[model samples]
Target: MRWIEAWTKIQTLFIPGVAGLREVVQGTRTTHPSDQLQCPQDFPLLLPSLILHSVSYDRTLEEIKWKLHEGQAHNALNELCQVLQSRAYMLKFKDSFL
Candidate 1:
């Protein structure tokens, strides 16, 4: 199997409820070993929503590729620098429009 495919099969343990866990295909399911996952710092937020959010089969691999190559969240934080700066200015000046 390919490296990515092999990596994909392994699930992570997430204690959902009292003694009731599920083996979900994605988004942090219960795994026998912890080493199976190599998650980033934002893993806590990403894991819960990986499967909950949808990407077409054709695009899933592409999205994964971008995730691996890009810094984080499709580089959303970087992309929104202007917006963040504007918000920061407004908040500093107590602008009501903000």
Candidate 2:
């Protein structure tokens, strides 16, 4: 359920048009009339910002997993705490925007 909610929010942010978020992220333009969704030009940083955030989260999780696999439970726990703190800060920041 949480995964579904997260994915839905991602889809909402990068609402796909005929051109798709991938094309916009790559700085490509499509000539199709239906290619315009949320006016990517108006929010040029949105897709890349989301992509970067997602990548950072994934990398952090992978590092934590690797640490655990190596029996470095203490380091993994510390990293997890830091990630939670970062997430809390982000949530507060997002709420400020709202």
Candidate 3:
């Protein structure tokens, strides 16, 4: 499926810097770092939350609170993921049953 492939590509894009990603996030604004992902199926804000959830250390909770206050992406992203999955499943059943 195209969506799976796309998600795979997105996962690959993230695979490179896991070791140094925290430093990169903390060190400098050389790049958004998160921009390298291809996440059409993902909530735009979900991407950052996903990253935060993944590599966040003890301070990540505080950081997440900050991001939540500053950005509306977290809630929006969760909703978007549910919507996309529901729609995708609907399409699948529609194609298969009808």
Candidate 4:
């Protein structure tokens, strides 16, 4: 199968408490206004909800593409690498002062 479809299937597997999550081939389920899902504060639920949320489907791939375009345009990958590199230093500084 195509990579995007494979990726989507893989992502569905990581969603917690969801059984048999499949791509909507026909249409979406109708939901009442008051029956909508509320975002939970717990990390386990929150992370999956954030990852699987409909808004992410539009922007995540674009964001990844932008981050991967290192030298062609803005070096977001370099900026991310710098942030990652500084993480340990920041933690050490915090531990020393706080």
Candidate 3, residues 1-98, lDDT tens digits: the string is 47655754664455433336534543453357775445544323224456655653455556767887767777788889999999999999999999
- Among all windows of 10 consecutive residues in model 3, the one with the lowest summed lDDT is 40-49
Ranking by lDDT: 3, 2, 4, 1
Q: Output candidate 2 Cα RMSD.
A: 17.5
Question: What local lDDT does model 3 show for residue 89?
Answer: 100
Choose the strongest candidate by lDDT. 3
Write the residue-wise lDDT of candidate 2 on 1-98 in tens digits: 45544654675544434134444554544456556444534434343335654332334545665776778777788999999999999999999997
Runs of candidate 1 exceeding 4 Å displacement: 1-74, 95-98
The ten-residue window of minimal lDDT in model 4 covers 21-30
Candidate no. 1 TM-score: 0.22
Estimated TM-score for each candidate: 0.22, 0.27, 0.30, 0.24
Tell me the spans in candidate 3 whose CA falls farther than 4 Å from its real position: 1-65
> 1-98, model 1: which lDDT tens digit per residue?
34444333333223122112222333354345664546543222323235444322234545776677787765787779978998888898886654
RMSD of model 4, in Å? 14.2
Go through the candidates in order and give each one's C-alpha lDDT.
0.46, 0.55, 0.58, 0.48
Q: Model 3: which residue pairs collide?
A: none
Candidate with best TM-score: 3
